[model samples]
Target chain A: MPMHSPTDTPLFGSWPRAYAVVLGALLLEIAFFYGLMHWFA
Target chain B: MSSLDWWILGGTIALLVLYGLYKSRGKQSFDDYTLAGQSLPWYHVGMSVMATQASAITFLSAPGQGFSDGMRFVQFYFGLPLAMVVLSITFVPIFHRLRVYTAYEFLENRFDGRVRSLTAGLFLLQRALSTGVSIYAPSIILSTILGWNIYWTNLIMGGIVLFYSVSGGTKAISYTHLTQMLIVTVAMFIAGFLTVHKLPTDMGFTDALRVAGKAGRLNLIDTTFDVKSRYNLWSGLIGGFFLQLSYFGTDQSQVGRYLTGETIKQSRIGLLMNGLLKVPMQFLILLVGVLVFVFYQFHESPVFFNKQEVERLNAGPLAGEFQVLNRQHQGLSAQRRAAVLNLQRATAQNNDAAAAAAGDQLDKADEALAKTHAAVSDLVKRNNPAADKNDVNYVFLRFILDYLPHGLIGLLIAMIFISSMGSIAAAYSSLASTTVVDIYRRVWPGSTHNEVVVSRWSTIGWGIFCVVVAQFTNRIGSSLIETVNILGSLFYGVILGIFCVAFYVRSIGGRATFWAAVVAEAVVFVCYYFDLMAFLWFNVVGCLLVVALAWLFTTLQLNLRPVRVADE
Candidate 1:
C-alpha cells in the first residue's frame, strides 16, 4: 500500500487545516463541558 | 451469580476465546504471530488500539471516579486527541516504514543498542507491573461479588488470558479485541440505561443531572491554572499531552496495536479514530457514574462499598464501634436522600427559591455523609492496617451486583473480564515481542533459535511473571486506575525524552542521551517521592529535562574534546 504522508494530505484541504479542525473540536468540547458544568452546577 | 448469569458469563468468554483462536488460525511464522501478518484493516487496528487502552480498570473505576469526583477526571483525556495527531504524523510513518517488531527497535536504529535496551527495559517493568494490577482489578471485583477467594480468582483470570495469548499470539488478541470492544460498548450503554431506569419514578434523567450537579458531581471542567492540581484544564492538556504521547508513542503495548495495521495510512487512521472517539467515550462512561450517584441519592448506598472489608469489621472487635458508625451513616443517608428528593421536586416545579434552599440542605447532608464515610474508612484502617482503605474501586461493582438484574449483571461482569483480557493479552504480547526482538536477540546476536518459539515461551513467561505481580497489587493503597497511571508516569516521561531526542535533537549522541535519561528519571522519582507536583507533570518534566540535559552534555563533550589537525 502507498503511504500517505501526514503533511502531503489534507482532511480539510490542507494538513494545517486538518490539525486546526482537531484542535477546534477539542476547544468546542471544552466549551461545551464548561457550559454543562455551569448549567448544572 | 445465578446459574443463568454463570451461563452468560462463561458462554460469552468461551465464545470470545474460540473466535479469537479461529480467526487467528494458520499463523506459523514469527511475523504472523507478532504482527498478525500486518493484514488487519484500519478498523481492526482501531478497535484493538481502543481495547488495549480501555482496560477493565477504566470501565470499572472511571464511573466510580465520576461518582465520587465528577467530570473533572474527563479533562485527564483532553490531551489525547492532540497526542493522537502527533503520533500519526511522526511515529506512524516511521514505524510502518521500518517494519520494526517493537517501538524500541526504532530507537536502536536511531541511537544504539544500549538506548534500545534501556527504554525496552523500562517498558517491560512498567507494562508487566501494570498488567498485574489489571488482572487483579477484575479478580477483586469478581471475588467480592461471587464470594470467591481473590487468590484463586487472580490465578483463574490470568490463566485464561494467558492460554489464549500463548495459543494465537497477537492475532488472537486483536480479533478478540474487536469482539470485546463491541460487547463492552453495548454492555456499558445498557448499564448506563439501567442506572437511569432504576431511579425514582418521578425523577427523569434531567432531574438526576440536577441532583448530581447540585451535589457537585457535574464538575466537567475547571479552567484553573493550579500546578498542584492533577486534572484541571491546563494540567490535563499539557501534562496529559506528554503522558499520552509517551504512552501511545513508545509503550510497546499500544504501539503493538497500531503496528498490526496493513499500511501506514491504516495505522494513522486507526489512531485518528481513537483520538476522535476517546473523549466522548470517556465522557459517557463518567456520565454513567454521575447517573449512578444520582440513583444512589434516591436510594441507600453502602457506608463502605467494600463488602469484604465491611464483613471483616462486622466480625472483629470493633463491631460495636462500626455499628455506631454505620447507624450514623444511615442517618446521614436518609437526610441526603430526603434533601435530594426535595431538590428534585422543586426543580420539577420550577420553584427556584425552593430548589436553592433544598440544594443547601443537600450539601449539608452530603458533608455529614462524607464525615461518616471517613469514619468508616478510619474504622477499616484501624481494624486492618494492611487493607486498602479506598473503596472507590468497589463502588460500581457493588452497585451492579446489588441492583442490576441477573442477565445484565452477568454481561457487565463479562464485559469487565473481557476488557481486562484484552489489555492483559496485549501487555503480554508486547512484552514478549520486546524481549525476543530487542533484548534476547541482541544479547545473543547469532543464536540459531526459532524466533517464533522464543516469542511463544516469552509470552508464557511474562504472563506468569505478571500474574505473580498481581498477587501483591492489593497493597498499592490507591485506586487501580490511578495507580496504573502513576506507575506509567514514572517511566513514560524518560522514555519519551529519549525518543524526543532521537527524533528531534539530531546533535545529541547516544551516550549523552542515555545519561540524560538516567538523570532525568532520578529527578522524576525524587519529585514523585517528595510530592513535588501532580503525577501528570512528571511527563512534561521528564521529557524536557532529558532533552535539555542531553543537549548540554553533547555540546560540552564536543567543545571539550581536542580537535584533530587537518594534515593528520
Candidate 2:
C-alpha cells in the first residue's frame, strides 16, 4: 500500500466542509427554483 | 445555405480541429494518448467533463422539451450535484490512488478479471450505442439544412470527429472541448436573448416569461411523488441521482474525462464544478425553449416543425386535406395570439376575473391549435408510415433557420456541430482506451510496446461501429434527448449496482457480483419490456436489485461451501 495525504484543503476548509457546501448549495437551488416556479406560475 | 453561412460554419469547425491538433502535438506514449498524461488542469478537466455530457441533442432537443413539455425536465438534473459530491468523496481518490487507466480496471483490483471484463463490456455496449445517438443528432442538422441523405451525413460527421480523436487522443479531445463549451454557452445565450428579442415589442423578458408561465411552459419544479412521472423533485433526487452516479462513476466516457486531471484534487474540483453548473446550464437551455414557446405566441408559428414531413405531406395525395388543416391552424394561431395579448394585459392590470376569462380563452385556443397540429402529424404519418410524429426535436432548429439572421444561424448550427464533436470525440477516446487497456492489453499482456497503435486502431474501429449504429436512430421516435436517456437508464442501473457492491459491500466476491449483475440486467430488461414504470426508476431498481442479489448470492455461496477449519 502507498501512503496518501488526507488533509488537503478543497474549496472550503476541509473535504467534509466542501461536500457540505455542495449539498448546501443544492438545497438552496432546489428551494430557490421551487419558489421561482410558483412565483412565475 | 448562404455562402456566408457556409463560410462561418466551415471556418469554425476547421479552426477548432486544427487548434486542438496543434495543442495536442507531443511525443507519443500509451498513457498520454489515453489519459492526456494525467496532467490536465482543473478548468480543462471541468470543461471536458461538461462537454462530454452535454451532447448536441442537449442543445437541440432540450429546448424543444421545454417548449412542448415545459421546464419540468430540468428536475432530471437535480440529483447531479449530490452525485458529484458522492463521486468526489468516494470515486475520485480511489481511482487516482489505484493509477488505473479505466474505471473497470478497479473492478479487477477489487474483485477479479471476470467482474472487470463484464463491467467493461457493459460500458462499451452502452457508450457505443449512446455515441451513435450523439452522432445522429448533428447528422439531423446537416441532413435537414443541406437536404442530403442522412446516411452520408452520418458518415461525414463520424469520420471528421474520428480524425481529430485519433490524431490528438485525450489531450486533443480536452483542448477542443474548452473551445466547444465556450462557443456552446455563448451561442445558446445569444439564442435565448434573440428569442425574447423577437417577441412582440410590447413584451419584455418578464412579460414573455409570464406568458410562458401562464401557458404552463415554466413548470420548473413539481413536488408530487409519482413513480411513473419521470421528472419531478422526488424522482429527480432519487432516480436521477442513481443515474448520474452510475453515469459519472462507471461509464468510461465520463470517467475518462475526470481521470485526466493532474491530481485527485483537480479531479474533485472539476467534478464539483460540473455539479454546481450542470443544473443551471440545463435550466438556461430549457428556458430558451420556454422563451421560444412564448415567441411563437406573437408570431405565425408552424403547425409542424419538421419541414421535410410538411413538404412530403404537400406533395402527397393528402395535399388538399393538408391545405384545409393549414388554414385551420392559421386561424387557431391568430386567435391564440389575440387571446395571449388579452391575457397579458389582463394580468398586467391585476384584473383577476378578466385575466381568468382570457386565460380560459387562451387555453381553448391552444387546444384548438394542438388539434390542428395533431392533424398535421397524422397526415405526416399517413404520408410515410414510418415518419416520426414527434416534431419536438426540430422545434428550436426550425426557429433558428426560419427566423434568425444568416450569420447567427450559421454560428448556432456550428455550435451544435461543435458540441456534438466534443462529445463524440470523448466517447471514441474512452471507448478505444477501454478496449486497449481492459480488453486488448489484458488478453495480450506483453503487447504494451504497441499499445498506442492498438488504441488508435481501436478508436477508428469504434468510430465505424457507432456510425453504423447511427443509421437506425431515426426509428426511435419522440424527443432525441429523452430517447438517449431512456436507453441509458435501461443499462446504467445494473452497472452502477455492480460498482456499488464493489465500493461498499466488501464481502461480495467476484462470482457473486458477476452473476448478480447478470440477473439484475435481465430483470431490468423484462421490466422495461413490460413498461413496469418510468425509465428513470429503472436506474434505481436495477442498482438496488444488483446490490440485494449480490448479498443474497454471497450468503448462499458461503453456506453451500462452508469454510474448512484447517488445523483446529
Candidate 3:
C-alpha cells in the first residue's frame, strides 16, 4: 500500500467540507436516535 | 444432554488458537511483535478497535444494566462518535506523521521526558488493573454457570489470553479480534432474538417493548444535568465525550490499535467507523437486556438471580427471613407478570384507560418486587459475608442458563470468554509495550541488544501481574463495569492534561507540567474520596484541573526564568 506523504492534503480539503461532513453526521445520529426512541419508547 | 456443545466449544478454541499462531509468524523484532509490522488494513484496525472496547463486561453486564436501570446507559456512548471525529482531525494525523510507537512517545517530543514517562506510567497502572477486572468479570459468569472454582477460572481465562498474546503478539491479537468480533456480533443478535422469542406467543416484540417501557426499562434519555446521575443525556454527551477523547486519543491501548494501520487514512477511518457504530451497538446490547427483563415479567424469575448466594442463604440462620422474602417475591412476581400482560394487551387494543390502570398496578407490584429483592439480598449478605450481594449483575446470566437451549448456552458462554480474551490480550500487549519502550529502554539506555527478548519477558511479567490482580478482584463487589470506569476516571484526566500541555501550551515545560499533574491528580483523588460528584464527571474535572494548574505553574516559571538568567 502506498503511504500518503505527511504534508499531502486529504481529499476532503476545504474547511467547509469538513464542517459539513461533521454536521451531517451529527444530524444523522440525532435523527436515527429519535426514531429509535420513538419506536422503542 | 448432547455432544454438539462440547464439539463447538472445543472447535472454537482450536480454530482461534491455530489462526492466531498462523498470523503471528514473522521476524523476531519488537515492532513486529508489538505492532504487527504496522501493516494492517482498515478492516483489521476497525475490528481490533471494536473488540478491545467490547469486553466481556459489555456483553455480560450491559444487558443486565438495561434490565435493572433501563436503556439510559446507551447515552454513555453518545459522545464516542464525536470523540472519534476530534481524534481523527487532531490526534491521528499527528501520531501517524510522527511515527510514534506509543501515544506517550509523542508526549516526550512535544514536551519533556518526564511528561512522557508520567503519562506512560498512568497508562500502565490503569490499563493493567482494568484488564485484570476484565478477566475477572467473565470468569465470574463462567465459574457460576459451570460450577467451577473462580480462582482456577481466572487463571485459565488469563492464561488462554496470555498464550496467544505472548506467542503471536499484536498481529495474532488483531486477527483473533476480527474473528471474535464477527462471532460476537452474530451471537449477540441471536441472543437478543431468543430473549424476545422466549416471551409468550401472544407477546410479540412490540408487546415486550410496551411491557418494558411500562416497567421503566426503556429509558433512553434524561435531559437532567445532575452531576450525581451516572447515565443521563447531559453526562453521556459532555462527560462521556471528554472520557472517550482521553481514552482513545491519549490511552496507549487504543492508540496502539490505530497505530498499526498501514496508512493514516485507514486509522482515521477505522476510528471514525467505531465512533459511528459504538452507540447503536451499545443500544442494541442494552435493548437485549430490556427484552430479557420483559421475558422475566411474563415468566418466572429467581427470587435472587445469584443462585449460589441464595442457596447459602437458604442453608444459613437467615433461612426463615429468606423464605418469607421468597414467598413475597413469588406473589409480587405473579401480580407483576399479570399486570405486564394486561398492559401489553391494553396498549395493543389502544385502550388508554385499561393501559393506564395496568401501568399503575404494574408500578405497585414492581415496588413490592424490588423490596423483596432487597430483603433477599440482605439475607444473602447476612448468611455469607463474602457473597457478591448485588443480583443485578447476574440477572441476564440467570435468564440465559435457565431458558436458552444447551448448545446455544455453551456458545454464548464461550462468546463471553472470547470477548474477554480479545480485550485482555490487547491490554497485555499494550502493557508490555509501554513497560519496554517507555521505562525499560529509557532507564537502560544503549541496551538495544536482546530488545525482542526483553519485550517478550516484559509481556510475561505483565501477564502474571494482571492475573494476580484478577485473583483479588472478587472482593470488590459485583459492579465490575462501574469499577473499571471509576478506576480510569481517577487517572485519565491528569494524563490527558499532560498531553494537552504538550500539544498546546508552549511555555509550560516539563517540570511545571509534571508538578501540576501531581497536584491535579491529588485533587481528583480527594474529590472522588469525598464523593463530590459522579465518577464520570471526574474525567472532566481532572482534565480541566491539569490545564488550569499547568498554566499557573508555567507563569511562575516564566517570571523566575528572567530573574535567574539575569543573575547568571
For model 3, what is the error of residue B429's alpha carbon versus the real structure, in angstroms, after optimal superposition?
A: 0.3
| Candidate 1, DockQ score (0 to 1) | 0.45
Which interface RMSD values do the candidates have, in the order shown? 3.6, 2.6, 4.7
Give the per-residue lDDT digits (tens) of candidate 2, residues B63-153: 9999989999999998899999999888898899888899998888787888889989988998899999999999988888888887899
Candidate 2 regions off by >4 Å?
A1-7, B558-568
Candidate 3 Cα misplacement greater than 4 A, ranges: A1-27, A30-41, B558-568
Tens-digit lDDT string for candidate 1 (A1-41): 23674533445575466667777788888899988888887
The window of 10 residues in a row where model 1 chain B has the poorest summed lDDT is B559-568
lDDT of 3 by residue, B1-568 (tens): 2477667766777778888888887665777887778889888998899999899999888888888888888878877877888787778888888888889887777666777788898899999999989989888886786777788989988888888788877888898999999999999999999887888888788778778777888777777789998888788888888888899988878999999998877787788678767877888999998898888887788998887787778787888888888888888999998898788778889899999899999989998888888877777777877777787778878887888888887788778878788888888888888888899878998885687777778888988999999998877876678888888888887887787776666666677777788889999899999999988888888888988887887676644121111111
Backbone clashes per model, in order? 0, 0, 0
In the predicted model 3, the residue pairs found to clash are none
If ranked by DockQ, best first, what sequence of candidates would result?
A: 2, 1, 3
lDDT order of candidates, top first: 2, 1, 3
TM-score of each: 0.96, 0.96, 0.94
